[model samples]
Target: MLDQQITRSIRKMIEAREERVRNGDANGYGVDFFGMLLQSPVNSNISLQDIVDECKTFYFAGHVSSSALLTWTVVLLAMHPEWQERARKEVIQVLGSDTPSFDGLAQLKIVR
Candidate 1:
């Protein structure tokens, strides 16, 4: 059936990724996302299928939530120029440039 074919395809894709990971072929791969799953000690005992499932769940949820947050943030900033200006000033003060750091991101209390 269609469900079985879909499942088989997904399984094949995950197996291919796992093979790439095991073969030291990191090129063209989004290592950071996979790194998160690998960094957890508990993940070592998890099967490839389970890891793929969890990654898929996280990917879908992250995409949905981040998109919503970005949309709302843009809308709010558009509506409040003064607050947005303040935020820009704070970013320039904390970062001294347009680039953001993890440390600088933490200091962006105005955005919070």
Candidate 2:
């Protein structure tokens, strides 16, 4: 199923990250995650595989939760045309009739 594929992909990515971390690649963000596990005061022998598993779990959970929230938000926005229109109006007002510049976008507190 699709779930299995997603799990496998996440596992592969986590394994790659773990290898990079173990090899002293400081540029990887995975090093931070690994460091947190290393710094834990629990008196247990945590293996590299365990760290990679934790990373995969973290990645999958974060992806699933964010995707669900975004889907829900889109559905809600679709159901509420008035709110969508209001949001569009606010965007237009902030951007003006021209292409939006960084300063113009910064002025849109409501959009932000």
Q: lDDT scores for all predictions? A: 0.67, 0.64
lDDT of 1 by residue, 1-112 (tens): 9545655766776667657867889543343555444433343566656656766666657888888999999999999999999998887788896444344577888965
Show how many residue pairs clash in every candidate, following the order shown.
0, 0
Where does candidate 1 stray beyond 4 Å?
A: 1-58
Error of 1 at 109 (Å): 1.1
**Residue-wise lDDT of candidate 2 within 1-109, one digit each (tens)?**
9756766776676566657757887454332544555433243576645655676677767788878988987897899988778878988877768655445666877
Off by over 4 Å in 2: 1-62, 96-112
By summed lDDT, the worst window of 10 consecutive residues in model 1 runs over: 35-44
